[model samples]
Target: MCTGKCSRFVGLALLPLAFIAIIVNLLLIFPNGETKWTNNITMQVWLMAGIGGAGLFMLCPSCNAIRAGGKGCCGEGCCGNRCRMLRSLISSIFGGLGSFYCVAVSGTALSNGPLCALTNQTGNAAQWGYHFKAMEDSYLFNKTSWDICVQPPNIVLWHIVLFSMLLGLGAIEFVLCAVQIINGLLGVMCGDCRKKENNNA
Candidate 1:
C-alpha cells in the first residue's frame, strides 16, 4: 500500500547513495595538487560524479511529479508536462555524457590489464619507473608508484588501482541509469493507478 509520496521518497533516497559512493571514491586515493598522480583517473571520476549528480537531481523532481500524476505538489505548474519533458531531456543528456565518460575510463583500464608492477634491470621487485628514483638509495627507500620512477618496464600499481576504481564507478553509473529508467517507466503507469484508486475511494 505504498503511496505516491512513499515511492517518491524511496527514489529520492537512492540519489544520496550514489552521491555518497562518488564522494568516498574520490576521497579514497585521489590526492590534491597539480601533480602527475593527481591528474591520473581523478579528473575522470570528478566529471562522472558531476554529470551523474546533476542528472539525478533533475530526475528526482520529475519522478515526484509523475508519482503525483504529471503535476507538482506546489500547484504552481512546477511539475507540468513541460517540466517532466524538460527534466527527462536534462537527465538523458547528462546521464548519457556521464555514462560515456565512465565507460571510456573503465574500458581503458580494462585494456591495461591487471598485475601492474615495476622491476629492476635484473627483474627484481622495485617501484614502477626508474626515472622516479633519483638515485639507487632513493629507489630502495621510496618504493612507491607516486614517485617519478622511470625504471625500465615500470608498471605503476597505484595507477592501476585507481583505474580499477574508475571502472567500478562507471559500472555504478550505468546501474543508476537503469534504475532511473525503470522508475520512469513504472511512473507512467503509476499515474493511472492513482486515478483508479481515487475513483474507487
Candidate 2:
C-alpha cells in the first residue's frame, strides 16, 4: 500500500515535467521565423490542435486519480499532503491557461482563411488566362480552370470541434484536481486528529 507522504512527493516531482511539456508545445506551435509551412492557415490550425491535445493528455492523470480514488498517494505527513496539494494546484492553473492559449490561437488562425483564397487568385489568374487560350490552340487543351480553395469547411469545422473538446477536457481536469487537493488537506488534518487521540488513550 502507498503512503500519503510518498504519493505527495511523487506528484510534486511530476509537476515540473508537466510544466516543461507545456512550454515545449507552445514553442512548437509558434516557431521562430517566416517559412513556407508557417504561412499556411490550415497548418497552423493543426499545430495548435496538436499542442492542445498533448497538454490535455499530460494533465489528465492527476484528474483521473482524484476521481477514481479519493486520496492520491500523498497520505498524512508533512511532506505528503502539503506537497500533493501544491502540485495539484499548480497543475490545475497551468492546464487552464494552456487550454485558453490553444483555443485563442486556433481561432485567430481560422479567421485568416480568406487570405488563402485571395492569394491563390492573385497568383494564378494571369498565368491561367494566357494558358487557357494557348491550350485551345494545341491538341484538345481543354484548359479547365481550377480555383484556389480552402480545405473544405467540414475539415476546418472538425479542427474547431476538436479544439473545443480539448479545452473543455482541460477545464474538467483542473476542477477535479482542485477538489482532490482540498480532500488531501482535510485528510492530513484528520490523520493528525486521530494520532492525538491515540496518544491520549
Candidate 3:
C-alpha cells in the first residue's frame, strides 16, 4: 500500500474521534448540562483525559501525519521517503500514548462513578460524595440504586454513557495508531509505493 495514502486515511479518521472525545469530556464537567457543582466534580473528570489525552495530544500528531501524507518531494537521497516514514512512526507512537491515557482515565471514572449529593435512607440528611462507589454491587446494574444520588438528576446514567463513549473512542484511536506504526515501519524500510510505481512506469 502507499504509505502516505494510508497515513492520510488514518489521520482523517482520528480527527473526528478526537473531536468527539473532547466534546464528551467537556460535557462531563457540566453535569446535567449545568455547572452548578463544578467544585465537586470527580477527580477523573478534572484530569481532562478526553480534552488533553485524546484531544490535543492526539490532534497534533494526526495533523502532522495528514500534512506529511500530502503529495510532496519524498526528498533527495538520505532525506527522502525514509525520513518522512520515520516522522510518521514517531507521531503514531505519540497518538497511541494519548489514546491509551484516555481509555484508562475514562474507565476509572466510570468505575468510581460520579460525585454528587446523596440523601440518606432516613431522608432527613443529605451530603455530597460518591454514592455508587461505596456499594459492593455495581450501581449500573441496579436501576433502583440510582435514586441515591439525588442532587444531580440522572447523573449516574450521564456518567455511564459519556465515559463509555470516551473509552470506546480511545480504543479505536489506539488501534488506528498501532496500524500506522506498522505501516510507517514498512514505508521506512521499502519506501512509499508511489515511487515504485513511478519508477516502473
Candidate 4:
C-alpha cells in the first residue's frame, strides 16, 4: 500500500513507462510503415493502439496532479487530484480491457503456433507448415512455423520468452491501471470539490 506521496512518485515514474509502451505499441502496429503493402492490419494492432492511447491519455492528469504537489484534492484527506482520479478510473476500466485484449491476442498467437515461422519457399524446405485459427468468418488468424526439411539448426525456444513477456506486460499494465482507478476514485467524489470541501469544513 503506497501513501499519497508514494503514489505520486509511482505515478510520475509510470509516465515515462507508459510513454515507452505507447511507442512499442505503435511500432508493433506499424512494423513496416514505409512499405506499400503494409496494410496488413490485425486485431492485435487495434488493441495495442488502444492501450497506447489510453496510457497517453492517463498521463496528462497524473502529470498535472504530481506537478501540483498533490493539492488537487476533491475533499480534505480523501482524494489527491480530481483529474488524476478520473484518469485512474478510466485507466483501470479501459486500459485494463486493452491489456486483456493484448494478452488474449498473444495467447491466440502462441496457441495457434508459428509465432516465428519462416521458410525458403523456392529452396529445399518449401513445405512450410501453415498454422491457422479461425476465430470467425471475418477474423481468420494465420502464421507459419518453419521448414523442417531445410532446417539443420534454427530452433525457436525463445518464443517462450516472447510469450512470457507479452503476458507479463499485460499483467503489469492491468495492475497499474487498476491502482490508478482505485486511488483516483477514493480521492474524489463530487461535482464541485471546493464547495464540498468548504461544506465539510
Return the top candidate by lDDT. Answer: 3
Error of 3 at 89 (Å): 1.0
Cα lDDT for residue 92, candidate 2 = 45
Candidate 4, 36: how far from true, in Å?
14
Question: Which 10 consecutive residues of model 4 have the lowest summed lDDT?
Answer: 134-143
Better of 1 and 4 by TM-score: 4
For each candidate, the alpha-carbon lDDT, in order, equals 0.43, 0.40, 0.83, 0.47
User: Cα RMSD (Å) per model?
Assistant: 8.9, 12.1, 2.1, 7.8
The CA-based lDDT of model 1 is what? 0.43
- Give the lDDT ranking, best first: 3, 4, 1, 2
**TM-score preference between candidates 2 and 4, better one:** 4
Question: Candidate 3: deviation at residue 1, Å?
Answer: 2.8
lDDT of 4 by residue, 1-201 (tens): 333453476467556656655655554444333232124333444555334543564465456435433545554444445555565455456656666665676565455433222356565433333222322321122223233322212222222334445655666666666666665565545322443555679
Off by more than 4 A, model 1:
1-10, 28-82, 113-169, 178-192
Q: Candidates 2 and 3: which is better by lDDT? A: 3
Off by more than 4 A, model 4: 1-3, 16-69, 73-80, 115-123, 128-158, 189-201
Error of 2 at 39 (Å): 7.9
Q: Where in model 2 is the C-alpha error above 4 Å?
A: 1-43, 46-57, 60-80, 110-154, 170-201
lDDT string for model 3 (1-201, tens) is 688788788889889999999999999999889888677788999899899889988887687667657654446334446666777789889999999999999888888888878877788536888877888998877889887788777788888999999999999999999988998888778766766676789
- The candidate 2 region of ten consecutive residues with least summed lDDT is 125-134
Q: How far is candidate 4 from the true structure (C-alpha RMSD, Å)?
A: 7.8
Candidate 2 lDDT over residue span 72-146, tens digit each: 234423333344444544554454455445545544443432122212545542221112122324212212221
